[model samples]
Target: MSGYLTTHILDTARGLPAEGINIALFKIENGERQKIAETVTNSDGRTNAPILPAEAFEVGQYELVFFCGEYLENHGLTGGNLKFLDDIPIRFGMDDPAAHYHVPLLLSPYGYSTYRGS
Candidate 1:
């Protein structure tokens, strides 16, 4: 099997990649979140290593929590008390064990979106 996982973040509002951002991956079971992986983004808005290695990859539900508040602030964005978004949680499920999973987040201070990539 060659299953694995990867992710990246882009700051749409600033037209730059989101670096220095922290992301945590959690496995969900019975409505509970158990931390599985955590890392900070590199200069390219992606971790240097795979989020989930093939040896540990499995079919299950997972949640990715992205800390975007500090990132926005670092990029000179300030919303004081009216920020529309901060910590963003994206939930997804995996059922295939032999495929590659790339989840990329396109973001701004107020909103974000994601899609599966090759």
Candidate 2:
């Protein structure tokens, strides 16, 4: 198998996949940030393609910023009424380039959680 990065977003409050949300992937080098790729979620709450394909995989610090606030607003949730979590930034690292890294976000308006998935 080859190494790559993938992601998923689940709207825990609605108990459904978060469709049409934007996600950006970035590579960090020397305290500076570089945009690697960006994609929007499909109906399945996943990007149409891998954020980082195997051939383009690299070893370094990375960040996945989710447009959670916009998504919440689009879903008809008033941000002014409930504002806690927005534009969630999840930073992680990858040292190996031959293993699959699945980063899934379980999200809510007030809080969220992520982990290095299988």
Judging by TM-score against the true structure, name the best candidate.
1
Model 2 per-residue lDDT at 95: 90
lDDT of 2 by residue, 1-118 (tens): 6799999999988999999999999999999989989999999999998999998998789999998887887776645766567788899999987889999999987788899997
Which is the leading candidate under lDDT? 2
Cα shift from native, residue 60, model 2 (Å): 1.0
lDDT tens per residue, model 1, 74-98: 6667477555677899999988999
CA-lDDT, candidates in order: 0.88, 0.89
Model 2 lowest lDDT segment of ten: 76-85
Give the TM-score comparing model 2 with the true structure, all chains together: 0.93
Q: Which regions in candidate 2 have their CA more than 4 angstroms from the true location?
A: 78-82
Q: What is the TM-score of each candidate against the true structure?
A: 0.94, 0.93
Clash total of candidate 2: 0
